[model samples]
Target: MTATLHTAPVTIPDTTDQRVVRRRLGPGHRIRFSFWFGPALALAIWSIGSATGLIKPAILSAPWDVVVAFQDQWVNHDLLGNIVASLQRSLVGLTLGVVTGAVLAVISGLSRFGESLIDGPIQIKRSVPTLAIIPLFIAWFGIGEEMKVITIALISLVPIYIHTHNGLRGIDGKYAELAETIGINHGEFIRHVVLPGALPGFLLGMRFAVTSSLLGLVVVEHYNAVAGIGYMITLAEQYGQTDVIVVGLVIYGIFGYCADSAVRFTGRRVLAWRQTLEG
Candidate 1:
C-alpha cells in the first residue's frame, strides 16, 4: 500500500469581516460641543449685528472688542488671579460640603435615631433658599473668604445629603440577607456591597453638588469679595464694561462645565466595574 500524504485543512478566521464597535458620544461630549457651539454661533450673529450697526456697540460690545478686553485682562494677569481666587473658594467649599454631607448621610443611613435628629433640620434648611442665607452667613462669619466658602458649602450640602441618604436606604434587603448567608461581616458588607450599590446615586449627587457649588460661588463672591470673578463682574458693571461682565459670566460657565465633567469622569473611573456588571 502506497502511503499518501494527508494534509489537514487549515481554517482561517475572517479577521477582515470583523465588526468595529463605535463608541457612542457621551453626555459630556455632546455638552462640550453644545456649550461652545451655541455661544460661538450667538457671538457670530452678534458680531454681524454690531458691524451693521443694528445693535449698539456700547450696549453690546463687538466680539473683537470682547476678545481685546479678554487679552488685556490676560496680559495684566488680573483674569488669572481672579480665576485662581474663585477656584480656591470653590474647591474649599466642595471639600467641606462633600465630607460633611457624606458623613451625615452615613450616620443618618445607619441609625433611625440619628436620621430623626438631623433629617428634620436638614429638610427645613433645604426649603430655605441658599441665596437668602448669604446675609446670615456674612453676618456670622464676617464679609470674608470664610463666609463665601461657608455659603457655598451650605448650598452644596443639601443635595448631596439627600441623594446619599436615599442611595443608602434604597439598598435591597435581599443583598444584606445574601451577604449574611455568605458570612460577610458588617464591615466587609459595607465596603464591598453597600458602597458599590450606592455609588451611582452618590456620584449623581456629587455632580449636582459640584455644579451647585460653582453657582453658589458666584453669589457668595458677589458680597465683599475683592478678587473673585463675581467681584470683577460687579466692577465691570459699575464702569459699563459689558464685555468684561460677559467675559466673567462666560468664565464661570466654563468652570461649572469643567467641574461637572470632572465629577462624571471620576464616577466613570471609580464605578467601571459596577457599570460593567450592570450591563
Candidate 2:
C-alpha cells in the first residue's frame, strides 16, 4: 500500500473591489507632450467638421478662419495691448482679493467674535450672485475701471475666504493643545501651526480665485469696456464676426488654462509634503 499525503486546500481572497483598473486613457494616465492635447484634438475635429461642411462658419468658424482672424487681430487690431490691459486688471484685482481674503479668513477663523462679525455678511454675500451685484456696483462706482476691478475683487475674495477659513477651523484641536503644552507663544503658534495647516486650503482657494479674476474681468469688459479681449468679443458679436469671436474664445481659454496651471504648479511646490492623488 502506497502512503498518500493530504494537502490543505488554499482559498483565494476576493480582490475585485481592491484592484486598480488601469485604462489606455484616464486622469492617472499623464500624456507627456509639449503641445496641448485637448486643443489639438479639438482643432483636428473642427478642421474635419469644417472641411466636411458639417459645421457652419457662421456658427463656428473653421480652424483656418480662426487662425486668419488671430493674425488679423494680432497685426491690425492690437491683440497684445488688449491682452496686457486684461491681464493688468486681472492681476490687480486678484492681488487685492487674495490678500483681503487671507487676512479676513485668519481673523474670522481664529476668534468666535471675529467670525460672528465677518462670517454672516460674507455668507449672505456668497448666496447672492456677484454678477447680480453688477448693476448696484455700477450705480455706486459707475462704469469705470474702479467698478471693473472692484467687481473682480468682490467675486474673487469670497471663495478664498470660505476655503481658507474652513482649512483653519479644520486644524486638529490636539495640535493646539500640544502647542500650548510646549509653551509656544500665540504668534509663534500661529506662524508654525496655523499657517501651515491652512496653506493647502489657501492654495486651493487661490486656484478658484485666479479663475474668478478672469471671469470678473470678462464680465466687466463685456458690459462696458473700450479695451480687453472681452471688449473684442463684444465687438465681434456686434459685427457678427464668427471667426473673431472664436479667436477671443480661444484667447480666454488659453489665459484661464495658463493661469490655473500656474496656480497648480505653485501649489505642488508649496504642498510637496502632502500625499495626494494629484501628485
Candidate 3:
C-alpha cells in the first residue's frame, strides 16, 4: 500500500540577508591587518637578519644599534634643535606653496583671462625640476635659509597647483547651472560647491607638497651652513656612522609618515559626505 506521505517543501534561508547585516557593521569585526601585519613582519625579518648576522652592522647597522644611536644623539647632540629647524622650514614652505597654489587655482578656474595669463607661465615653471632651480636659487638668494625655504616652496607649488586646478575644472557644469537657477551668487557658489568639490584634489596636492618640502629641506641643508636632520645625515656620512645615518633617515621617515597621516585624517573628516571604495 502506497501511503500518501505529506512532504514539506524545504525552505532555504537566504545567506544574503546574513551578509547584508555583517556588511552593515563596517570593519568592526575584522582585524586591523595592515596596521599590525606590515610592521610586525618587518620587525621579524629585521630581527632575524640582525641576529643571524645576515645584515652587517658596518654597512647597515642593526636595529638595536640604530636605537642606541638615536638615544645618544637625543642625549648629546642637538637632535631636537635640528628637528625644530627642519619643521619650521617645512611648515613655512608648505604654507606658502599651498596658499599660492590655491589662489592661482581659484583665479584660473574662475576666469578664462586669468587662465590665459597664469597657466602658461606656471606650466613652463612646473616643467623645470625643483632641484635644477637650486643653482639659480643659490645665485639669487645665496646659500642662506631664504634660498632653502624658497626652493621648498617652489618645489611644492607645482603639484598643489596642478591637482587643485584639475579638481576645480573637473566639477560638473550641472551643479553650476543648478546654483544659477537658485540665484546663487559667485561667492556662495564657490563656498558651497566649488571648494568642497576641489578639496580632495587640494588634499592630494598637499601630500605632494609635504614630501617636496622635506626633499627640498634635505637637499638645501646639505649645501651650506645648517643645523637640521639633513646636516646630521651629512655628518654621519662624513664619519661613516651608518647607525647615526639610519637614525637620521628614520627620523625623516617618521616625520613624513606623521605629516601624510594628518593630511589623510583631515581628508576623511572633511570628505565624510563622499563614500570612498577603500577599505
The runs of at least 3 residues in candidate 3 whose Cα sits more than 4 Å from the true structure, single-residue gaps closed, are 1-40
Per-residue lDDT of 137-235 in model 3, one digit per residue for the tens? 899999988998888888888889999999999999999999989999999998889988999999999899888888888788898846989999999
TM per prediction: 0.81, 0.86, 0.87
Error of 2 at 237 (Å): 1.3
**If both were scored by TM-score, which would come out higher, candidate 1 or candidate 3?**
3
Q: Each model's RMSD to truth, in Å?
A: 5.9, 5.3, 5.2
Compared with the true structure, all predictions reach lDDT values of 0.83, 0.89, 0.86
RMSD to native, candidate 3: 5.2
Tens digits of per-residue lDDT, candidate 2, 1-279, equal 999999999988666433333322335544566337877888889899999999988779998999999999999988998889899998888999999999999999999999999999999999998999999999999998999999999989998999999999999999989999989999999899998999999999998998888888888998778889999999989999989989988888898888888888889788877756665
Model 1 segments more than 4 A misplaced:
1-59, 274-279
Q: Mark the 10 consecutive residues where model 2 has the least summed lDDT.
A: 17-26
Top model number, lDDT? 2
* TM-score, prediction 1: 0.81
lDDT for predicted candidate 2 compared with the true structure = 0.89
